[model samples]
Target: MKVQNIRMTATKKLIEEAFTDLLRKKGIEKITIKNITERAKINRATFYAHYEDKYQLFDEMIKGAATELINVHTKEENIWNQKQVTCLTQAVFEYLNQVKMSCPYSYQNLFPLLRMKMLNALKTHLESLFNSNNISEIKEFNILMYSRIIYDAAEVLVVEKTNLTYTEVIEEISEIILDNNQSF
Candidate 1:
């Protein structure tokens, strides 16, 4: 039973990776079931066995990446240290970087669906961590504000509009978060 689950998971990952590779090289509009099946070395029939269409595959890929990116930043219960936010920034950047690195033309393809959720989720993470701060408690407004800064910084990074390194961006935001300092 466990083996079957593992096998399924592996197959799913394979499909996502294959699709991502194709997307990286070309625009999403250019990808087809034949393309993915060819890349994954699976049968065309097997492709439909897993997903309804390319968009479905893309959503699964984004969601899986989203969960992973969210987990990297907000997964642990730390004191909102520089390291944790760094992880968050790195996770997000890494996701975008992968797309950009492999599929520069296609990276933006996921942004429309991915952007808002990423922003909101980052805000939630910031607020959650802020609420748990030992010295300063976070309010809703505070979280929203800090989250905007983080989102903007992250967006800049995603869009290649900023020169800040991922760690530097997180560090700068930490300062902003500290400035908004409140106690619980």
Candidate 2:
């Protein structure tokens, strides 16, 4: 069973790498399942067993990336604070910048979907932190609002090419969120 799991993991990695390669070379629209399977040297059945479609594969990849980014920037079990918030914003900006570099041609077309997925992932992470910290008073709406504010601020700083340096941007963001000394 362990060996089977290892093989499955290897096959999924192959599929993801193949898809990314195709995405870089020919963009998403031109990259079909057949193209992915051919590049990955896997059968259609194998591909289907792993992912229902290319879009699902893409989404899974994005979610995995988001999770990794969150883990790197915001430690698990940490309560919400100015540093954590800034780190989370940094993660979002870094992830989006990576997407831009990874698929320059498709970035514009994929931005909306990528933004939505990233926001959802960020919200999930925030909700986990909020829950673990016993912030029971915080509602789902508040979580969503906080996530949006963080995500949008990061987006503006990254995509808009603001005059402020990264450190300065994060400092301002931190001030904005932590100004009232409101407890998270």
Candidate 3:
């Protein structure tokens, strides 16, 4: 059973890697199941066993990436502070930059999906932070608004491939969050 689990994990990783590679080369719209399966060195049966279709696989991949990205900046007992906020913004910027660099062509194709996933993850983390701080005045809607602002800023930076340094972006976002939260 353990070996089977390990094999399943390995197969999934291979499929993911192959899909990423194909996405980079052919872009998502052009990538077919045959393309992914051929690149993964797996059959259609294996692909179907792992994912219903390319869209499902892509959705899962984006969600997984967003979760990992959020985890990188959050701790078990994350404190809601400017520094942590800065770090979170920095993480988002760096993650998006990495994605842009790694998959230039496909990045544009996948930006909307990636942005939404990242935004949702960011909003969840921000809500947790706000709740932990006992900031009862700040509603869920406010938190969502803040998350959207940060996400949009980060998206613009990534899409533009701006000349601004990570620190500059981080500081700006941190200031925005700190300033807005002070009202609560």
Per-prediction TM-score? 0.70, 0.79, 0.85
User: In model 2, which runs have C-alpha deviations exceeding 4 angstroms?
Assistant: 1-6, 131-137, 181-184
Model 3 residue 102 lDDT? 70
lDDT (10s digit) by residue, model 2, range 1-184? 9999999999999999999988777667778999999999999999999999988998888877877887898874387888788889988888888877788667666767788877888889988888888988778987787788788887786567678987887787777665667555
Candidate achieving the largest TM-score: 3
Tens digits of per-residue lDDT for model 3, 66-107? 767778776643776667766677667777877787777777
Per-model clash counts, in order, read: 6, 0, 0
Clashing pairs in 3: none
Error of 3 at 30 (Å): 0.9
Instruction: Provide the lDDT at 4 for model 1.
Output: 85
**lDDT, model 1:** 0.71
Highest lDDT: which candidate? 2
Ranking of models by TM-score: 3, 2, 1
